[model samples]
Target: MGCTFRPHFGYCRRISTKVNVLITVSDDIYDVYGTLDELELFTNAVERWDINAMDGLPNYMKICFLALHNSVNEMAFDILKEQELHIIRYFKKRWADLCRAYLLEAKWYYSGGDVPKSIQCYMNETGASEEDAREFIRCLISATWKKMIGEQSMTSPFSKTFIEIEFNLGRMAQCIYQYGDGHGVRNHETKDHLLSLFVQLIPP
Candidate 1:
């Protein structure tokens, strides 16, 4: 991936890779480690951008929050210094939003109802049948993809390399989640997929 995108800008490769890793780690923090109370505290801390907000959090949560906070800020600083672009606010907001979404899922899991595995909102809010909820989600995913693809051709304040990196991030996510939570859980197919892409050699 780095070699393929190097001509566009080698720096983008490093930043994009870091961002992807951060995304996965953040997902685990929300999915695996967080309890309702802890996740709420952490989410609020991120939204507030306050180290003081770390008070009362578990040690593990503090560590996760600090890592996310510092790494994102550092990356934002690098972007500002190098490109004169300040995107820290956007990054912070995105993190907060993601945490809220995860919190919703966690709440649903704790709820005593037999909630559908995905699209809980669609299932719970509108009293939609499972089939209808699935269809709605499919359309929503298609719309999101359309929006992202449309951005590829738009006139943006960001650099072309940055735009390409964003596109690649979306593509990577699609690949990882296409067959389920492939990144979070190991399975034979996921292992084979990774090996085929990263381990097996292909002759020119």
Candidate 2:
């Protein structure tokens, strides 16, 4: 997805795209498809990092988990072979954190309590007042962008191409969350951008 510029880090860009796809799929499963119990099981399986742990998952969840696991492992393999870096720990930690965050949202959604839709589920989970939640969203987005910008200015082990990909991702994430998941809803502007970005032919 970050290959729009025809950069030399095509492999890393592809890996980044795969990681994004996995996260999107898993988010959909947890938010739209899975029951609370099934999500718990799947999250546990990921946390445990055991193939056997996947045995109890539903067929759909098992499929999603396998795709995520295999893709992550393939990326790790690439990093290891090319960079002499064993970054699997970083990948695993990120995935586990993703699962935990998603699980919290799912729990809040299914708690069967009368929670106002105006307040985000995470706010409900955190016992934040609606006003506080609203303020927090602003602060969170600002803080996240600040951090990414700061990271971009710093020296890091990651390649410049990889950092650019991360910055693009953060920007996209901010856009997606700023207006109620426009990408998922395929809002007019989002649909137009998606079509242009993903479907239009490039001039040779």
Candidate 3:
């Protein structure tokens, strides 16, 4: 996340962090707290992407939905003002997709059936060992990174800074989840990584 100090860069980082925090809050609501009916209402509100949709949501969900709506709208407003691009539709689609995925997972949980994770699915499909599945997953990740790098090298309408920011987001996710779901669960490894990057000093 290192960059030459610029107001634009600082604003981008702040908005990114805010979105990530909102995502974590949404995930917790889906996975830990909200009942199926409440989750449905919340997901529908998000899918609608309208303040008016908040009417049916419970109190907690109403607060979360309003926060998400306001933050996303504010970001969209900034982008529209600066870039002259109407990207709210793109943002809304992504959020809707995320909520749909979360809702599916919640449905799975309430059904009382164990769902195999990606690693397990790979192992089951290929009759591979756990280690082999992990290696396969690593290979897939590497290939995806290669593709992203290739895309970065190609021509695009986006500015170089914007492309780099998008690429860095992928890198950030890799670092955070390198060990596990670091964002979802606090672990010593993630704590140490953050500390070293943001808090600690290097000796010359």
Checking candidate 1 for backbone clashes, the offending pairs are none
Clashes (backbone N, CA, C under 3 Å), per candidate, total 0, 0, 0
Sorted by TM-score, highest first, which candidate order results? 3, 2, 1
Residues 45-146, candidate 3, lDDT per residue (tens digit)? Answer: 899888898898889899999899999999999999999999999999999999999999999999996656889999989999999999999999999999
The TM-score leader among the candidates is 3
Q: Looking at candidate 2, what is the lDDT of residue 10? A: 71
* lDDT agreement of model 1 with the native: 0.78
Q: Put down candidate 2 lDDT per residue, 53-72, tens digits, no spaces.
A: 99989999999999988888
Give the winner by lDDT: 2 or 3.
3
Per residue, candidate 1 scores C-alpha lDDT tens digits across 1-204 of: 322356656665666677667677767777777888888888889889889999989998888788888988998999899899999999999988887887777777777544356767788898999789988987987899999888778788997766766667667766776666677777677777878988999878
As for candidate 3, its clashing pairs are none
- Which residues of candidate 3, in runs, are more than 4 Å off? 1-7
lDDT of each: 0.78, 0.80, 0.88
Candidate 3 differs from the real structure by a C-alpha RMSD in angstroms, to one decimal, of 2.3
Error of 2 at 64 (Å): 0.9
C-alpha root-mean-square deviation, each candidate: 4.0, 4.5, 2.3
Candidate 2: lDDT over CA atoms?
Answer: 0.80
| lDDT, model 3 | 0.88
Error (Å) of candidate 3 at residue 24 is 1.0
